[model samples]
Structures are given as C-alpha cells and as structure tokens.
Target chain A: MQKTLKSLSNKDPQNIILIGNPNTGKTTLFNSLTGLNQKVGNFPGVTVDKKTGNFNYKETKINVVDLPGTYSLSPNSEDERIAKSYLEETNQNDIIVVVADATNLKRNLLLFTQIVDLGKQVILVLNMMDLLQKNTQEIDFKKLSKKLNCPIIPINARLDKGVEKLKEAVFSYQQKENIFLDSDSSSSSIDETMKRVGKINTIVDDCLTKDGEDKSYLFTKKIDNIVTHKIYGYLIFLGILFFIFQAIFSWASYPMDLIDSGFGFLCDFVSNILPKGILNDLIVNGILAGLGGIVIFVPQIAILFAFITILEDTGYMSRVSFLMDRILRQFGLNGKSIIPIISSTACAIPAIMGARTISNYKERLITIMVAPLISCSARIPVYTILIALIVSEEETYGIFNLQGLLVMGLYLLGFVAAILSAWVMKLIIKSKQKSTFTLEMPIYRTPRWKNVGFEILSKVKIFLFDAGKIIIAISIVLWVLSSYAPGNKFEDISKKYTSETSQQQYSEQEISTLIASERLEHSYAGIIGKIIEPTIKPLGFDWKIGISLVTSFAAREVFVGTMATLYSVGDADNTMSIREKMMAAKNHETGEKLYTTATTLSLLIFYVFAMQCMATLAVVYRETNSIKWPIIQVVYMGALAYFSSLLVYSIFS
Target chain B: MGKSLNMTLDRLKENESGIIKQINDEDLAIQLLSMGFVIGEKIKVERIAPLKDPILITSGSSYISIRNADAKNIEIIV
Candidate 1:
C-alpha cells in the first residue's frame, strides 16, 4: 500500500492542457506531442469533443488535453464554454501550455495572459516561428519571458521543432502569481479586456522588432482579389462545388464497389464454412449485411472529409463562409452552415456533427434539423434500382442519360425541400440569442497532410463504431422479425412444398424458391406490412412495398436487400434480375402491373423525402442532446414524405 | 463623440484605413478587443464580400470578417 501510494504521488503533474486562439497551430503542436496516441470523447453532459492523448518523456507518461480555440476566457459559444469550464476545474498538478502564433502574437497573447492570470501553472509556446523569421521579425523571448514571469519557448510546430523544449518546459513549469488586468478596477468585462489589451500591446512592442513590412498578407490579398470578386467569386464557388460532387459520385464509386464485393466474398465464405442454421443465416445475412451497408459509405465520406479538411487547413473555408453568410443568414442559418449543408450530400451523420461550428444556438439547431432532408450517398443504390425500373440506361435526352437526369432532378428536389424546411423552421423555432458572424480568416497556406490524415481516421472511426453499433443491432432485430412467424407457419410452408406431387410439378430449385416467397408472406414482417398496407395504398404501394418500406427504415439502402428477399431473388447485386421480377409483379385485386411509372416515381419520391435513416436520427438525438428534436424531425420529415409521395402518385396516375 | 466626427466601419470603402474610436455594443466591444481590435489602433478594410454584406477587416496581425450590421456598431475615424 505504501509503495503504490508513493508511485501514485510521483505521477502527479502528468497533465498538460493546451489552449490557444483560433488558427494558432495549437492542434499541430498537440499532434506533434501525442502522435496518434489520442482519442476523442465528449465533455461531460455535452457533445463537444474532448481530445486527450498521452506521450512518454524520460520513461514517464504525460497526458495532454487539447481544448477548443477561443478568443478569450469569456464564453461566446458552446466550444468556448467547455474550454473555459475545463480550465477552471484544473488542479495545481496540471500545467497549462498556451500555444500562440508567433506571427500574430498580439492577438494570441490575449489568451495566454488570460490563462496566466487564472493563477494556474502555465508555459507559453510561441508556434509558427518560421513564418515570423521569413518576415525578418525578431522577438526578444528572454526579455518577454522575464516581463511576463513565464517561461516562453519558440518552435515551429508544423516541422516538430522545439517540441522537446516544450516538453521539457512542461516538466519544469513553476506556478507564478501574475495578473494582467485588475478585475476590481474595471466596470464591466469589456473594460477589463480593453485594459488587458492595452498592457499586452506595450509588452509586445517592447520585445518585438520588425525589419520590413510583413509580406504574408500581400499574397493572400492578391489571391482574394479574384477568389472573392463579386461575379468571379460566386462562379468559382459553384465550380468547386460541382467538382466536389463529381468527385464524390464518380471517384468514390470505385472504392465503394471494392468494399461491396469484398463484403460479398466475406459473406459467402462465412456461409460456406458454417453449417446451414439460424446462426449461419444471422451471421451472413443479418449482421454481415448490415455491417456492409454501413461500411460501403466509407469511401464517399472519406473523400468528402478529405476535401473539407484541405479547404479548412488552407483557410479557404472561412472565405467561403464569409461569402455565404449573408445569403444563408436570410434563411436562419449562419455562414458556417454551408459546410454541413454540402456535407449532407455524402452523409448526414458527419454533416450534423459539422454544425458545431455555427456558434449560434438557433442557427445550429436549424441546420441540424434540416440537414437530413438533403439526399446522401446511401440513397444512391435505391435511386439507381428504382430509376432503372421506369427509364432504361440507353434512353437519353440529347447528351444526358434519362436515368442520370432523373437522379439529378431527385437531388435538386431534395435541396429545395431542405431549404424550404429550414425557412419554415426559422419562423417557428424562436430564440433570444443574437446572431453574429465574426469569423477569422487565416492567411492561406498548404494543408498539413498529416493533420488531414488524422482527421479522416478519427471521423471514419466515429462513424463506423458509434453509428455502426446501432445499425447492426437494429438489423439483427429486423432479421428476427422477418425470419420467424407466430406459429409453425414456416414449417407448414416447407412441409407443403416438399410433397411428392409438388416436387414432380415443379423443379427442386423452383419448389424451394416458391416456398421461400410463401414463407415470407406468412412471417411476422408480412403481417406488419399487411397492417400498414391500407395507409400506404394511396401512395400506390402494395403490401410487398410496405414490407420493403418497414425493413428499410433501419437504412435506406436496405430496400434493395429486403426486395430481394420478398421476390426470392438469389443475388441481391443483380439489379437486372430484381427489376425483371418487380416488373412481373401484379396488383392482387386489379391484376395490373405493380411497378408502373406512377408507382415507381412515387416510390422514388418517398425515398427522397422520407426519414428512413436510423443512423441519422440516432446522430440527431446525440447532437441535439434532446429526444424532442429527433422526434420532431421524424414526424415532420415523415409527413413531408407521405404527402409528397401522395401528390406524385396522384399526378402521375 | 459627435456624430459628425465619427463614422461607422460599414461605410468605409475597401482598402480604406481608420482608427477605432469606439464599439457601440459592450459585448461586441469585448469580442473585438479580445480578437485584437483595440481602441486607438489602425484598422483597414481588406475586402467586402461579393454580396456586399459581410466585409473582411484587418487590425495589426488579426484579420476577421463581420456582417454589415455588426460593422455598423464599430465607430472609427478616417
């Protein structure tokens, strides 16, 4: 007991909390210190990411927590609130490392001085030293360090320089009694901040010397001349958006195909190795199929995230936000909502998470609520199969494929619906918080590729694990609901199909297939479908379509898998076979073809508008931190889908 | 503090420079100050967005964009 207690005490001062202003390269320093040893979690009672990592120095493990960047100790946003609260809770054993951009020391030091005045043990790290050197500027760090009563270290975080010195400083950090502003002398928070700024300006001027004017912003301003030009800016923004869409749809398809086939091969292997039983079916059909559906979207998501990270790292996203803020704010969304709105095309889960940057409560909530209305990549499979039902691949209107044109129209329809919903919500959901867009526009630079890689890895991990767990569990439940019946109905179907006369009338393969389809009709899922058939009948959907709708509620792409089972189609990948089977299906009462143009188009419209993605709802619940929002989302979106599909069915029929 | 002596930042043309006299809103003042926009400091209008609502401005080494409504709260001397 004594030895353990001694060891525990020796491990004291193991934590180093990193804080800084926006665009200060603080994250780069954290990456250099932790180097993939990091994990992102949520702060207690909130969804803000709490990134904590550990690194070893001299055989001792030092843990680091990278806090969100904020302009001051006063909180203006959720991120800043969490950062400030976390800082206030730190004990004496924890040392605060304030990373400041050397090129912009005047603004960066405001955060550092605030932390130092908090009476916490702190070390000042001056990052971006290389940029300062390029401008022929010099900082008398020793004098600055003495005046501030803090140990200051200069290093280029991007190149991993001076990281060792930073770690060394963390080990030897001593608490200093310092205060930049006397709080009691100020009449308000604003007055205190102004006084602090006045003091910092003097200190910065005394220690820093410049040989010439900084040329960094000169180049940035030159590029901005064209990039932010009135006509050219809007055109360039659209061009880049079009390019991103093309990349997502075309480039991502190759990897998506690979993942699809790979999962198929794995399913086959598992089925062959295991004995034909409930367990084998569950593994191959239920669990593996569900896993594949989620993983198949990885390529599209990664590509989208890569592009977004590059844009942000190069400081272009802020420019885009500046250009878009005025227009978006008219619809109750902040400028930062542009990222999440566009991101919804690839997936809504990450898109919803991306709304964290909006800062304003009402705007962020509206962005989250309406984001799922935009079509995502998971809708691609359903659209392809359904569009092919009415329009052939060979059919074209001039140069555009008819099927492709219809898909684009569906995408456009989704965008219009989303914008309209946001506008309506803006009028309904009331808030007292004022909306402001005071965004920093960092100077452009080449993206840190390593940081981009880390971002992709972390986001993909969250999607695959956090959302994947719920998807797999729901799929298993759906499988059991569809595979089993109330009585010995499944056995009865099998037994009748095994009769000698039946065998003679139909081939062995035909008999089995017939039994499979008949058995599904008697299953619990079929009963549920029949129960809801009357409600969906106005949408030109039959009981079979109802079954597909119910099953696909767990995931939009599962409509294909469920349809394959309903028709007893052996291969789910063979879209042509499914199309043929669906074409032959008939209305039980009228004896008319089931997949008419009206019904197919209605179904396509439903997929476009419906809240069919369970993962998105789950993410919405987590992000909003309230059951009310997700419930509201489901009801509103479902009503929209039903009414829209009803309208399309009427117009076409 | 006369109206004739002060001009709001929103009226400044692109590439124009001014000295900040006051920020009308207290919260906005704290925000701008912490972001390195102190009083008596020279601020330059970098660019007005394409739509002419939110404009980018630079003070010292800090550059940021604020909407026209927020910019109107900032009093400056040309």
Candidate 2:
C-alpha cells in the first residue's frame, strides 16, 4: 500500500479536496478533473465510497480526494461523517473546492457558507452553468465572489467547459492572500437551522437574478405527477423492473453463450495442442472450466450494473425509493433497499456493496442478510435442468410455456422469501443504529451516459477484484481436491482395467472409461462424498450427488460441471448428456428411480435457499466488517434449505 | 384550515401545503432539518405512497420521502 501510494503521487502531492452537495454535478466535475486517473477505496474504517486521484497542474502534482456528496456539514449518515471529519482535520496547505449548482443556488450555498465560516481558504465551483440559460437564471459572479470572499468559477462539468480556467483558478488561488469570513464556526448548530436557511436565502436573493420562478422544475413536476402517482407510479415502476429483468436474462444470454463456447473451445484446443499429462489435464479440465464459470456471468453483471447506473444518472433511482418506502418499511428495509434487492438477482456481491448508499445501518444489514435468497443467474443453470427433469418441454398453455412459468415461479419464490426473511431478521437484529429514511428526489433528465458508463465499468472492475479473487482461489483449491487421490488405489484400478483390456471383449475406449470411473470412486473427493452420503440420504441424494453438493460451495454453478464430470467417467459419450446419464443410473439395492420428482424438487429448493457461493460470504464479511453476519447468514439459510427440502421431498414422495 | 390547521406531516392531506413548525422527534431532527425541514420552510405534499404511510414532500427544489413514524413528529401548518 505504501509503495503504490508513493509511486502514484509525486513526492507528497498537494491535497486538493473536492466537496459538494448532492445533485450539484460534483461527480461530473470530479471526472472532468481526474478523468480515468483515480483510485477507488474505502475510508479507513467506514465503508462509504472514497475516490482519490492524482493530476498534474502546471508542472505541480495535485492529489484530489472526492468526498461523498452531502447536503450540509452537520453529519447524519456515515457518508456525511466522512466528509465532515475530513474537512475538520484538514491540513493547512490543503485547498478545499466546494462544487455548487448554479441553478439551485439557495440550497447549494448552505454547505458553502458553513465551510466559509470555518475560515478555510476555499474555492467555489459553480457547476451546471449550461442550465442557466435554459432556466433564465444568472449569477452575478463579481458580486457573489465579494460577498463570499472566495474565488468562484462557473463551468458546465458535463461538457468540460471552463475546465482549464477552473484549473488555473485552483493553481493560482494559493498565490493570492487568504481571505476569511468574520463569523467564527462555533455559532453553527442544529438550533440555527432557521437562521442558516434564512441567511442562505438572503444571499441567494441578493446575488442571483432570474426572470422566471421554478421554471426548471416545472417539467420535472409534470413528469413527477404521473411517475409519482399513487396507482400509475407503481405500475410504471413494476413495468420498468420487469423490462430490466427481461433484458438482463435474455440479452445477457448471447454473450454468456459466446463466453461458454469460447472457453470450451479453448480447453479442447489446448488439450489437443499440448502433450497429454496431469498438468495438461488440470489446466484443460479443472482450472479453465472453473474460470469459465465466473467469466460467463460477466454479461449479466455488466447489464445489471449498467441499468443501475443509468437509473441513478437519470435521477429515476431516488423516485424508486420514494415509491417503495412504505411497503419496504414494514419489512424494516428502507426504500433504497429496492436497488440492492433487484441487483441481487444478477449477483449478490455487487448488491451487498450497493447497500452502502443506505444511511441506516440496520436496514442495510438486513438487506445484505436476505439478499442471497434471491435466485441469481447462477441458480438459473441449476433450476433449468431440475425443472426440465420434472416438467416436459412441449407443455404450453396457449402463449405461455409451462416450464417457463415454473422458472418464473422460482424467481418469485426467491423474492417473496427474501422479503419474508428480512421481516423475520428485522425482529431479531439488535443494534443501536439510528433509523432515518430521507431520500433526495432529483429531477428527471436524460442520463449522463458517459458518467453511467464509467460507473458501470468501475462496478464491474470492483466485482472482479473483490469477489472474483475469492472465486478463482476457491476454484483452484476445488480443482486440486477433485483431481488427486490420497493413495496408489488409483494406480491399482488402472492396472486392473489394463490387464482386463487384453483378455476381455471391451474396446480400448470402454476400458479407459471403466478405469476412469473406478479411479474416481476411490479418490479423496469420493471418500468425502461417501462420508456425507448418510446425512443427505434423507433428502434422496446418493454419494455422487453428495460430491456435487460439496464441490459447489466454490460457486453454485459448479454443480453442473461436477455432475458432468462424475457422470462422464463411467459413460463419457458425445451423444448422451449428463442428464441422460443421471436418468440411466439406478441404485444397487433397490432398482428404484433416481432423479425422481421428489429428489429433483428437493435439490431445486436446496439451491434456492443455500448460501453455496463462497464469493458472497467473503463480500458479506467485507461489507459488514465482521464475520458474524455472514456466518449467521450461512447457518439460517442452510437450516431453511434443509428443513424445507425435507418437507417438500416428503410430501412429493 | 379545519383539517390542516394543526396537522403533523403524517396527517397532512395529499397535495396540501404547509410550513414546517418543528420536528419533535430527536432521532429524526438532524436529518430532516439538514434536508430543509427547517421552521417556516414551505413544504407541499406532492404525493403519498400506496397504503398512505410514506408521503413525498417537496421542500424548495428537493423532493423527500418520510415515513409515518418520522412524519408524525414534524409539526406543520396549513
């Protein structure tokens, strides 16, 4: 950490702070100033978003810390506290930049004035200058600069206009003598809310002039009337949600198919190109397949986050929270919890991190706890096969396919279970965390596509680095466990099969498969599978199914590959599939059916509720800053999956 | 004025206008006040969510959602 920080900065780059009120185009300005040259991380202990970047200004290096956008200095949420504390403990040479919205000067200046009263050398950046002409509002820059006793620069951050001038002001501001306001910071308090509002209003009235009143928000109000309507609002919201879900599932499938085939082709190509050995087999069969498991889901993750950022950029996200507030509150979740819950459908790692926006800790915790209950894209693989076994492909009711309806039912069941679990956990989690659910509904506008794109790119990168790291590591460990055996029992099986090859009527291919299956049955993984066979027998699973269950802890989707491998050793054929193989298998003692309706349904229920993915547990630990929540999450979900499967299998049998 | 005269935020009718007199709840005081629920600020109930508990209020140029528990403490005027 120390080495990277030193290498990035040019020997202690000057600390230039970027602060602002929410919706002031601060993020756009930060992007304009730093571009893609930024390092994203968490502030020391708190998990609020912290972005720092290094840029060169006139041969001098400037290090800028982008504090989370806040309303005022008096802190409420953890995000607010980070910005407030940073300003309070500011270094002497640090230049504080306050980004303000030019059109909405009255409210934006509230924070600017508080910082000015702190007697710091501050620069006021009047952003969104492009909207001034549209709103017919004008700021008297000369008069406003004199009143505030600070350097003020007006620029439209989106278009990157006046950026060089702003940079010049930032660099040259240090050359000028420091100016301080007369009042000390002591008088600012919650008791003076009225006083502060009145003062800022007066300042706004004096230095700002406009021909029309509230004209900018008039269009916004018109849209809000319909979008925020009692009945139509919810209908539109659900409609949009359904649209997004369809896009995430259907559109992502194209890229997912390409990725899957690409990996399969690569593995086969490498196996043919390289000399056959254990290393070649490990790379071709184990490592490449494990990596393909995660790389395929990238398309779904990219689409889900792209939609999330687009909603945020267009200002529709806060309105969602506004609509969901009442219903979710009954489950002890905030309106903001909707984003995470929807995001969980794609993957839980990003969903848990997205909960950082929720100011209330308890609500965020509950959201994280119940998030994995939502059926993710990984579960779709498991659900599709199981549902296929239980239901027929040709069964359709006019327009809707019966099998597709069952898939939809599984999704709805996951969501209903998430909310219900949240309701139950709400009554249990005891925290002194204060509850506040106030959301600022920004006016609707065409999304800032550039900003949205950048945000999506960053979220995907974070998902890869945080969850992807754990996934790859666990997959490697699983590869080792499944590939090797403890003793020469594998050699004995190969020897026995080879000796019989010369004396028997079996072909070389048939002999090799027998040897493969025999060796796998005596491997360490097989012994472990046998150990858990009795425990899972009540759920109608055998030792082979137990192996898939154990290996899938690395990722839920690995269950498919595990099943394919286990089935292939005995009957590896291009014509017959893993499902067909499972269908052909029968118990030695009773010639009874396996993969029956009861067992398949039980397995589906198990995948729906079990916390099978290690990546999610790692993220939950990182987000909660404790292992206790993730541990409790695993236990309760495991217990739920177990008992529910037991009940469902019994009734079905 | 009969219904709106001494109503708290939770009791305010949909599309009603009021000036925030006080936010009596301690837990909600800082957040609401900072988000511009200050005394004498004119707030209009733009809409109420379904089930009539969480209501949207527009203060200045900002629209915010407040639950019944927090809204019950926000004393308002017609």
Candidate 3:
C-alpha cells in the first residue's frame, strides 16, 4: 500500500511543501535543497505567491514549494493565507518538511504538533542546532522523533550540518506512521481537546529531557533592556545609522574611483580607433560616458544593500521595528512601517510592495504614500555629485566631514518629510479600525554570507539592468538630437574636424573634442533642450539641464550621465572627470559659473523632493495595482520639487 | 466557568472555539486550521496569535495554530 501511494504521487510529481515559523532557517533549507534552481512566482488568484524549486531525492524528482514563514497557519495576513491554503489541500503535498527552531522548541512545537495531526508525511527538522550549542542547550532528538512519531533531524543550516541526514530521512519517508488524529466522537468538545493537548504535553515531557535551561526569553529581555530603552535606544539607533552612512561614503570611494578610471580608459580606447566620425563620437562620448557616469556609483549602492541584507538576515530588523513602533505610531504608521521605509532607501517600488506586510489598511496606505519620500538609491548618484560639487571636505562638529553632514541632512529631511506627510494624511483619511502590531523578535544568529552575497548580487544586477536599458536608449536619442539639425553648420564642422588632413594635423584630443561638441549642439536632444530653455530658466537651469531633466524621468541617476555627456562636448579628449566638467561649466548667456554653490544647492533640493522617475511610478502602480496613488505621488512630488527649487533659487540669487 | 459557553471553532468570538470544519482562507488560514484542524477534529481555545486578533486553538491531536478574525463565524454545538 505504501509503495502504491508513493507511485501514484510520483506519477503526478507530488509537491513537497516546506513550512516553518519565521527565522527557523527555512529559507536556508530551501536554498540547500534547490540551490540556484528555485523560481519565485505568485499563487493563482492571489497576490501572495508561492516559491517553488526542484530537487531529486533518491530516484524521486520532488517539486518543493517553500511556503512563507508564519507562526501558525493563521490567516491574518496575505502571506499566511497563501501558505495555509497550499497545506490544506489533501492532494497537493506528498510530504511536509517542518523546519523548527531548536532554541525555541516549545514555541516551535506549537506548529509541529499541528502538522503531525494533519496526517501528512512529516519530516521534522530542528534548525539552528548550532545556536543550541552556543547557548549550552541540548535536545534529545531520538526522544523528540519518538514522541512526535515522525523522523526528526537536527540541522545547523548556517553551517550546512545534518542536511544529508535530512535528505536521507526524506528518501526513507514512509506513510505508515500512526501520526493522524483518531476521530473519537466522544471527545468532540473544547474541554476534551484541551485535556488531550495537556496529555500530549505530558507525553512530550516524558520523552524529551530539556537541558541547560531555556534562556532564550531571558536573553531577549536582557538585550531589550538596553536596545529598546526609550532614550538610549533612539540614540544608539541613530549612532548606528550615522556610522553606516559614513562607512558607505568612506569605503565605497576606492572601488568607485577604480570603476570611473576603467570606464575612462575604455572610452579613450574607443576614441583612438573609430576614425573620428559620428559613429566613433557616439560610442565614446555619448554611450560610454553616459553609462560610466551611473556605473561608478554601483559600489556605493552594493555596499548599502550589503549592510541592509546583514541587518535583515541576523534578525536585528524586527528588534529595530519593535523599538521604533512607539515612535512610528505617533505618525500614523506602525513599527512594521520601518521595513518599508528602510527598503525605500534602495527603491520605493519594493518598499511600497513590502507595505503589504503591515496588516492595517490605513497604515499600509500611509506607508505606501510616504515611502517615495525616502531618498532611494537612484537619488544617491544625484546627491553624491551635488554634495561633492557644493560642500567642501572640511570637518564639522569636529568629527564629521561637511560633505557627509550634508548627505546626512538630506536623508533626515526626506525622513522628516515622510513622517509629516503621513501625519497629515492620517488626519484627512480617518480610519476607526483597530489595528494591532504583533511581531516575533527572532533569535539573532550570524548572517549566512551566501544569502547576503546572493541578495546583493541580485539587487545590483536588477538595478544595473533596469538603469542600463534606459540610459542606453536615451544616450542614442540624445546623440542623434545633438548631432544634426536641418541646414545647420554642425555637420560641416564635424566633417571638417574629421577630414583626413585636419584629423592628422590636429591632436587626437582636439579632434575628438571638436567633433563631440559639434554633434551635441546639432543633435535632436539639443533642439528639445533649447525649446524647454524658457520653462526651466526661472529655476536657474540651462538647456543642458533641460535635456538632463528629460532623461532623468527614466531614472534620477541618469541626471549625472546627462551632465557628463553634455559637458564631455567641450572637454578635450574626455579626460576631465564629471566633477571637473561641471566645475568648468559657465552659462553661455550670463558668463557666470553654471555649477555655483547656489545652483548646486538648488539642484540638490530639487532632486530631494522630485518624482523624477517614470520607472518608480510604474513600479508603484504595479505593486499597488492602482494608478490613483502613483499619479498623486507624481503630481505632489513634482510640485514640491519645483516650488522648493524656486524658493531656494530666489533666496540665493 | 461562565455557563460553559459552547461554539464551533469558526464561530468562536475574538476568544471563542469550534471544531474547524473547513478552512477557507489560504496560506496562513490553512496552516493555522490544519495544525490540528481536520474534519471532526476537536479543539480548545488557547490564547491568540498575539494582539487578541487571531484565536490560537489547540487541537486534541497535539498541535496549536491560530484562526482568522472571522473564524468566529463558524457554528458549533456542545
């Protein structure tokens, strides 16, 4: 009968579901089983999707579905609902892998016992066994297995221990275990159920000998005393944040410079070979320079994600959420809102999507509304360049660089703006529904470097791919716009500079630079910039900035690239860095320096509040499945940016 | 205790009980309902999954899980 059941399930590729509470090392187990073969997708008719991966255990090809981490199959959130539905379907899963945290076995068993009664083929995995060793705690696995009437394997997922035993248990899985609940009609009452559970607890106690004291709760209380204390907690959190930003600035510089120089060399090499024509000029000046401008900032973005991934993986994020909950509640947000807010520092799309975790509709809406206000990674390039241009490197307050201080100020301003806006929205959109914030503070463990590395690489790849596509297309268009115009002397000038005798006579730098400038001034992009000159003039922006503004709608980081390309026109040999080009720029009409401190400040403030990217808006729409919020976001942010820039420009000018 | 209130696991209030007849919600709902929730399965109210929201119930079969806010909508007779 067991063989017949196995064969029948095998004919349909039985779905082996992995279920566990949050922070049980469930994801690590999934990674081990699937390696890089896993794919994430949404479940049918539900926004909360399932992540399924394939692996072969013995001769059986198993399709493993990694359910979302939940304390129990309580349908409070969308994630929980999706997880519960898949598990309840009798025919859906052939076996269930219940990953439980060994350190907190009492609470973990709350879910394990439930799975046992479901009559599903069960493999109980005691994850984080290493943490038990660290805490000097031991569990009798043999007794645990016997008590539960299921195979139990102790695993240290972080160290990849006992995984083979887990696989072996899966291979040797049998359906004959008498783990199912007997339908006793006499004990159908609530009192009877409680009595049975009490009796089971007695059985559990008899079978297992718990050793070295349960210090998990005590440890949490001790840590919470200092970390979540009102005044000191806030101070420590601020201090940690300050250090992270400082590290991002100081550590990323070396790699950033290397990338910049490498791209510069590549540009020069292309300029050397391509025989001084439109094709050569486009490749070296337009494409390479535009891409290099954004590529140089990748190191900083990657490092920022690395820190975030570590914080999230080590289970510190929930504690941070718990600590911040009280403060956030004051602004119509919950402690849970911090996740989305922090994620928004990378990009608002995912951050807004993350708002779904917040159970309260009103709080979730407020989070989504205000998330875009947090300066995202796209804004980083703009901020870095602008701060470098305006703020000197002198130390302030005896410990912080003036540039670093300015960057910090911008981040704080965004956060302040987000909170203030949320507060206002709360007043207008009143919700009387009672919302509770209950978060499980998971045990802290050393971050698995593999997961962190994978997260960073995936995010960086996504950022690069999305930004690269837009930059390349816009660069080509800008090249065409700046290269030719009807009845213009621009083409004539470019040809003359590239003519055989003139090209040979003139230095390579002079020849390339002349062709670049001529092409840009006559390109289609230049015409559009000239047309928009009137509109942007009041904000102290030139036609070059107009072109940049247009391109930056795709992504804010493209502003730096647009400026690089615009300035590269006049730069001899493309030798000057973006900063040097910006510093050298002078207004053609006014003859005043284009990137004066006032203008830089104005640009910085403009970018601080602008809904500059169409991509972010698209993502927001997709994530929320609503056009209303994204449209409102764009209009409000655009107005804020314009008026703020106008205010700064007027005051300074 | 208090008239020995009898209600179905689904019909139980913010803190009520009835045997889970069928779990309609997916993912979380199913997981919570399934732990000890099967046809004709008996359950007792434990606390809730925090926040006095989802009711935590222990099934007679030796497992505990939470039910939805509307879980009280289910009918039961003692």
Candidates sorted by TM-score, best first: 1, 2, 3
Evaluated on CA atoms against the true complex, candidate 3 attains a DockQ of 0.06
Q: Which stretches of candidate 1 lie over 4 Å from their true place?
A: A1-13, A353-360, A377-408, A430-433, A544-548, A551-597, A613-627, B1-4
Per-residue lDDT over A253-369 for candidate 3, one digit per residue giving the tens place of the 0 to 100 score: 899989988998899898997898778888887899889987888888898888888888976787677666656877999878999898888888768767877877789889988
Q: Which DockQ-derived CAPRI band holds candidate 1? A: high
Q: Give lDDT tens digits, candidate 1, residues A1-653.
A: 12343346455748999999989898889999999999998788766778899999987889999998898998777778789999999876678889898888888888888887787778889998888988889999999999888899999988999999988887666545677666766377877777778888889899986645676788898988888888888898877865665566567768977997887688778878989887887777678766776787788778767887888899887888888888888898989887888778767877897788777899999999999898886687688678878988678888656665677788889988988899999999899988899888889999999899999898788767865766677667667777888989989988998888898899977886677667666788778888999999999998889987987777776776566445532323223344577777778669899899999999999999999888789878988889999999999999999999999999999
Q: Higher DockQ: candidate 2 or 3?
A: 2
- For model 2, the DockQ equals 0.57
lDDT of 1: 0.82
Ranking by lDDT: 1, 2, 3
State the lDDT at A361 in candidate 3. 79
Query: Quick one: best DockQ, which candidate?
Result: 1
Quality of model 3 by C-alpha lDDT: 0.73
lDDT of 2: 0.76
Against the true two-chain complex, what DockQ does each candidate achieve?
Answer: 0.84, 0.57, 0.06
lDDT by residue (A125-205, candidate 2, tens digit) is: 998877777877777889888877788999988899988888888777652344333444566456565566677777767
How does candidate 3 fare on TM-score?
0.81
Candidate 1, pairs of clashing residues:
none
Clash totals for all models, in order?
0, 0, 36
